[model samples]
Target: MPTCPSPRAPNGSSSAQLPVREKELTRQYDLLASARRGLPMVRVDRDYIFEGPSGKYRLVDLFEDRLQLIVYHFMFDPAWEKGCPACTRYVDALRDLSMLTRRNTAFALISRAPFPKLETYQKERRWDRLWGSSFGSDFNYDFRAALDEKIPTVH
Candidate 1:
């Protein structure tokens, strides 16, 4: 009997695919799709204030009326001593994410950094992706990314 070559994972390792039950698969998919429904339809179309190199822009308008929003909430708050390297990696990879808007999906990065601060960081890191600083906004609070004083730091 001949053996077949296993599929290679992105990490250059061979891993066997896991088996799945058809019924359970269907249930998982349905639950995920339902998350987008049963909401008061928070108008994700409204343009919010955002500044770029050229000038200011309404954030939602940049997507050109796409499938709502795909905001990448980041940890660029002043509370942190420095920008997160993990977050930096994500932002660096995100420069090529224009496809999201091309696929009719609005894409943006939300950070607590002031626009000027973010601009400085971007220049230092050589980041060229479209990003926005949500200064003076409750975006972090609304999205539950805000730091909780009650929660103790494990590290």
Candidate 2:
């Protein structure tokens, strides 16, 4: 992760000289972050299976013994030949995320597309991040990442 730059005044002054509005906005942003951290957590009871390069794996396996797992629900519909352009761009913009491992967190990309397609795309893009396929599983629908009229949501 990149470090946040210290706030600077328009006149090349210190952050202590920042305008009232900027300070207020920073305070509001901090409060919102605190609220998000305080939100209640839900336990996942369902066992979701995913396909990867090695083989099929359960949802808990994606954690890789890390304290937390961060999954990026990349939008790649089964019928589509390629991933979403926006999602591709976002992945392209990502920097080295190895820093996350040091924080006891693991990250992976989960898509509804078949594993073969995801593997080919990952190789073509030269991305070494862990990618998994949720095809034939309710993982995406249960997480509200994939939408389909035929599949009933698990509200």
Candidate 3:
């Protein structure tokens, strides 16, 4: 959703010195992004499940009839009393969920906290997006979002 600036003449002002190679690089990046969408998907056999707003659901269920799903692995540990402040801030940026739904894509959050605690933190942040807990499951580990049992220092 960004517009490309038009190339300026040699006599143009100082700020108008955008390189022609930059535009070509941008085009190449866009092509790569388009190609990434067509990458082959490996079948998942594990019955990984999560606790959701409406009971428990599997990983595929998170897609919610959409072909593409974006799951943000929130770093909220089970022992933490409150959700991560940084993750909370990132969630605040996704206020408009309709944009993704319109594009046939769904987005959700998965955390390591238990269902009840995850629910409480979500309520405190007043978040409306779909969130689930991977507490009794290996969803986080399988996805490599959670590294071992140690919680990383945020500071």
At residue 147, give the lDDT of candidate 2.
60
Ranking by lDDT: 2, 3, 1
Local distance difference test scores for all models: 0.67, 0.88, 0.83
For each candidate, what TM-score against the reference? 0.60, 0.73, 0.69
In model 2, where do residues sit more than 4 Å from their true spots?
1-38, 149-155
TM-score-better candidate, 1 vs 2? 2
Question: Which tens-of-lDDT digit does each residue in 18-91 have in candidate 3?
Answer: 66667989999899888877879888889888998899889899999998999898889999998878888999
Candidate 1 — which residues are off by over 4 angstroms? 1-40, 44-48, 79-81, 150-155
Candidate 2 Cα deviation (angstroms), residue 11: 23
lDDT of 1 by residue, 1-155 (tens): 99766554444343433223566788887887786465565554434576666567776555657766777776788555457788888777765666775787877666777788778887898977667777776656655676657543221
Error of 3 at 89 (Å): 0.7
Candidate 2 lDDT tens digits, 1-155: 79665675346556656677788999999998898789799999999999999999999999999999999999899888889898899898988888898999999999999999999899888888889999999899888778678765332
